[model samples]
Target: MKIIIGSLNPTKVGAVKKVFNQYKVEGLNVPSNVSNQPLTDQETMQGAINRAYNARIAGESEIGIGLEGGVIIENDRLFLCNWGALVYENEVILASGAKILLPSEFINELRNGTELSVLMEQYTNEKDIRSKEGAVGVFTNGRITRTEIFEHICELLFGQYEFKKRKEENN
Candidate 1:
């Protein structure tokens, strides 16, 4: 089956291709325009929907993916929410990675209006914050690999799709 990932982003491309490869699904990466501003969780989800919906209108594909990030509050702490929206033709599938946990005190500081990227940069103090090919970035220092995190997101998406398919078959 043909799967169209909504963005030409290298990270997203790497993530999707890695996960879908195991399923034997042929995945395609299409160029998509993502907004510059960071999205809220709800807005992030909406962004995914927008991307997938637009992709469907653009052409025929078995699946489409939209990856987005947002900040969410829980127990007075702010967390980084990175997720992917997987659309299977007419059906919409949702999947999310585990939230990158933040310290409560730091979350409070961010809540006071500090950007997480800046905070992360200042905390590391090595510059090039997005670099995941090393011991920096969100998924480094032996914590998590970028590929593994994205794979989790993809797993949730495909797993949900499989669940639905099974449900439908049973009925």
Candidate 2:
């Protein structure tokens, strides 16, 4: 089957590749149509959905995968969140990664309307932290990478798709 991943970001592409290695996969820069730093879980997931649908149509492929990272608030505390989606034919599967709580200082910065990527870049004195180890990797002390976070989500997407197929066939 042909697979397309939405986003030219190396980490997102790498995450999908780890799961769909047996298939013909292509990575294309597709618009998510969401803010660069999505502020809520819903918007983040919407980005993933939009990317997946757009990529599938753009590549004329059987499957499309999208991954997105964002920040969310729970009980007035900001946390890092990521979401992923897989689209196939008339079906779509969605999965989310673990949420890592942000430090209070970063939360304050975000509340002041700074984008997460920009804040992270300044914090680490690094460039393109969003496309690299990511906030998850830094916050997690390099134990879990951005790629691994989305990789697990991609695995969940395929697992859900397979489970749905089996259920339909059995029915």
Candidate 3:
């Protein structure tokens, strides 16, 4: 099957490739049609959905996958969140990765319109940290990576897709 990933970021594309290893995967910089830095769960999911839909429409691929990472606030604390969406024909499968609570230092900066990605880069002194270890990696002391987060999301998405396809086949 042909799969189109709605991002050129190596981490995101690599995760999708790992999940759909048997298929032909193409990475493209499709528009998410949402905030550059989503600040809420709903917005982050919307970004993923938009990217998935746009990627599906951008080519003749059988599946389109989109992964988006952002920060969300719950109970006055900021947390790292990641969401993914898989689109197949008229069906869309969605899944999310585990959230890691961000430090209090990020709360004020985030509320002051500072993007998490920027903060992460500054905090780690590593450029393009989002495309590398990511905030999850730094917060977890490298226990979890951005690619791992997206990979897990892809696994969940693929599982749901397989079930849906089998259900349709049985029907």
**TM-score for all models, in order of appearance:** 0.69, 0.94, 0.96
Instruction: Flag the better candidate by lDDT, 2 or 3.
Output: 3
Question: Which candidate number has the best lDDT?
Answer: 3
Q: Compose the digit string of candidate 3's lDDT tens values, residues 1-171.
A: 889999999999999999989889999899999888888999999999989988888966888999999889888888899999999888889999999899877888887888888998898888998889888988999999999999999999999998998999999
Scored against the true structure, residue 152 in model 3 reaches a CA lDDT of 98
lDDT of 2 by residue, 37-146 (tens): 78899999999999999999999999988898999977878899999999998988999999989876776767677899898888899999879999999999999999
How much lDDT does each candidate structure score? 0.63, 0.90, 0.91
Q: Per-residue CA lDDT of candidate 1, range 1-171, in tens?
A: 766666655556677788788543333444335443243567566767666655555547667777665567777766666667877757888876667655555666565666555666777675644334222235446576555666678878878888999999999
Q: Runs in model 1 with CA error above 4 Å?
A: 22-35, 73-76, 103-140
Q: Flag the better candidate by lDDT, 1 or 2.
A: 2
Clashing pairs in 1: none
Give the lDDT of residue 81 in candidate 2: 93
lDDT over C-alpha atoms for residue 41 of model 1: 68
